[model samples]
Target: MIQPQQQSFNQKIEVSNNFGIEVYVKREDVLHNEISGNKFRKLKYNLLEAQKLGFVKLLTFGGAYSNHIAAVAAAGKEFGFETIGVIRGDELVDKYLENPTLKKASENGMQFEFVTRTQYRDKNNATFLNQLEEKFGDFYLIPEGGTNDLAVKGCKEILTDNDKMFDFICCAVGTGGTISGIINSSYEHQKVLGFPALKGDFLFQDIQKYAENGQWNLVTDYHFGGYAKINDELKQFMKQFFKKYLITLDPVYTSKLFFGVINLISKGYFKPNSKILIIHTGGLQGLQSNIAEI
Candidate 1:
């Protein structure tokens, strides 16, 4: 069984004093250069279980710039499994070089199957899965965004006894697996706040399926026009944030999480002397896709 490196918590200096609240970030991004952040946690046990089940190939779904896709490719290479990425957009097939995320995954030996967006939506349908099984021939399927019961089980290990001092736990929600695990492991008095990168209320229902506790809430106001969408304001914020704190946040997930946490602090949403812990769910590889634009 391949094990992910354990990470430690680091305090943000300037932001900690803002609004009289102390903020700390768990440096899950530094856990691994390729398979970093929540992706590593989500894939940790899934890979183990696949190996235990005597599976040699791993099949999963993701978008053009999905961090999960890149992480799975790297993990498969490291753990001796064949990887197949069912990409969302068919147009991306001929233009993989233009997208760094896809390029990296391809370089890591992951086979790609491009599908239309409408067809991709039926990824969980039985008929769709049956077709994939017939085509791929006996492979373990990991859902899009890597959210599953085993994934949530791995995520629960993110928080530990040392995290009990925090009043609130914050994380970026993609498929809700990471937050679900944090909510399950958090202290009773601690409130889990999820800043979603996508715009929609559907995540509430998705998360409710896995989270066992009622202490978590989704902050839906900071998506910045939805998934993989960004603007100059968000770009400038990330640039200055890195300059000040020396922490590079990806435009997809961690950026929105920090943006929401800071905005909530300025709005007096959190009480004074509150200790807030933010999960830095890394998607740094996605930064390469936006480097030219941002």
Candidate 2:
């Protein structure tokens, strides 16, 4: 359920003076809700799994600006579940945060529990969850970014209507769920490409394990500066991209992959006349605070 804006099928190639190759964007930023993007699909199967497991409470993790957290919180309120968001770090000055993602999560009636970065890493541990079950009672846990089988299943639904096959399908890889899901459902004629937003060191293995040997291509380059970091060049390109196409690309995830798509295309990567489909994982709500200006 990518927001209406993110799911929009408006498709075309926009040639920008800044980018050497012709780029066609899927217009996911406009898919649905202002907050739509990758978050909805990631949560879809997860919610179903929660229901199947007979779980009443859902606990997950994210940074203050995390799209997954916001999506889960909103989904919880809408679908009848107790949602707990383990926000990384203390709240500090909430007003200083430019991204309204966290605020929206609260409005969605999601409960929050802030933890140190160190503790957050071990949140999936038996001890942590045992304590949680003791206090909250029957609950299911979803990994950060909603990385799991349900996410892949939901993403598979993205392929039903589109008939075109692609030389390579690319997406901004955060936790490897979106790309892996696409690869799993991709027809033989298509190959999946992933741009790691963080270090790709163990990501290939992660995707393979998660997806169970689906057709995939790992194109590592466009992680401007790790997961949450942005740079001036990325901002310049984001602005230029929108100016040429009148489509918005927030500075966080999709923008990074959009940049990588161009970089790979120009460097003798994609075959000529090859159809390259990019999965815009949606996170516009998380982009309100990031730099996207030249």
Model 1 local distance difference test score: 0.88
Off by over 4 Å in 1: 16-19, 291-294
Which candidate has the top score in lDDT? 1
How high is each candidate's TM-score? 0.95, 0.87
Give the alpha carbon lDDT tens digit for every residue of 23-96 in model 2: 45555555446336666777777787788888888998878777788778877876788898878776433551
State how far residue 13 of model 2 sits from its true place (Å). 1.8
TM-score of 2: 0.87
Scored by CA lDDT, what does every candidate get? Answer: 0.88, 0.71
Compute the lDDT of residue 153 as modeled in candidate 2.
79
Per-residue lDDT for 176 in model 2? 80
Best by TM-score: 1
